[model samples]
Target: AELEIERWKNENAPPNLPELKEHLQTKKTAFVLQEKRLKRLRLLIDSNKFAEARSEISQWKKTGEDLSGLSEMILNLEHIEKSDDIVLDLKRGLAWQKYPDSYIQNLKMAVDRCKSIQSIPRKSFNWRIPSKDELLLFFTSNIESKVQYNSGSYWSSTTDKVWSDYNWIVESKSSSLVRTLKDDYKFVICVTDASSEMIYHYLDTLKF
Candidate 1:
């Protein structure tokens, strides 16, 4: 639950990666399903059917569904992307994630959520907070038009050399990168390997 805001000097430190592909597969599948369920609940709330909405959620509780992410998802409904697609940018060799434990978090938490999705099979790719340059690739006019990406200021793993506590973030609105405190709350988009083999591996493992 604790997202670590990395010190500037430790920007290149290795991430905590999930070794079991099966675990990653199971977790990703459940998360995608839960997101679908929440979207339906979101529609109910939008329609102002408060009682009906609460009743639907009661069923989830009875079925032992994990509602730990419920509060954050429901409260931040507007900012969260509706698409559950795991996008692959072949040119960059990166596969992007649409969901996070919370859409908005401090730099540390955002990176932690990304690291949770990393899988190390025979051919490995680690997920972590993208660097400023990596994130810039997403903010481009051409890429923006093609990808179903989340729109907002996003924290980057790249940090300042001198400032030590400052980090870079991309503001989607202005399409610019700026320095800010590591503790600042911002959105996240996690990326991992999108190699040819990894692509097939992801679809087969996660059942895309």
Candidate 2:
């Protein structure tokens, strides 16, 4: 009699478990569809399809769809493009033909200022001044020459040819020679103000 009562109860119970399972499956499908849509939007933006990407965003907005991911993607793409544009502009400006005459002159003036700040010391008695050949060789090899003698003072010549005329005279001594060179000669036909240290550093940085 107890077994029969148990069986009857089981038969009469409502079948709600299948309904709950179906609802959960439907939610999973919707989540997957949203993820795919977001991925496509990102791809479009990355490929520079801004118009189509923007249109998709508009549709999402009208449908009251969540688009936090898509909006962030678009913002990131725009930022990357802006940064690239600035870098391209600087590169183009550095090219001899691309820069305006006034800009080049300004750059030269800045270099001159850096040179004025450099230190120059008289040659010591023991160490000899480099000869013209030696100077040329040093310049070609891209090496700065420093002469230290028994006296407490030492003299240094930048290997750059810009100061070759003033080469005999001691000029600026700051280690940041490249910045000086760039600032002084960016616009000049002859980069006479460039320092050996600057040229060496520039070449070394290039691994050339």
Strongest candidate by lDDT = 1
Q: Give the lowest summed-lDDT range of ten residues in model 1.
A: 72-81
lDDT for each residue of candidate 1 in 33-144, tens digit (9 for 90 to 100): 7677667766675664545655666666334434433422332221122324455565775656644334589988887787776332212456778889988987773545
TM-score to native of every candidate shown? 0.49, 0.30
Residue lDDT tens for model 2, 84-130? 11111121111011111233333335334324421211110011233
Instruction: Name model 2 segments beyond 4 Å from true.
Output: 1-15, 61-76, 79-85, 88-208
In candidate 2, which residue pairs get closer than 3 Å at backbone N, Cα or C atoms, i.e. clash?
111-183, 111-184, 118-172, 118-173, 119-173, 159-196, 160-196, 162-192, 178-198
Model 1 root mean square deviation, Cα atoms: 20.4
Clashes of each: 4, 9
Superposed by TM-score, candidate 1 places the C-alpha of residue 115 at a distance from the truth, in angstroms, of 1.1
Best by TM-score: 1
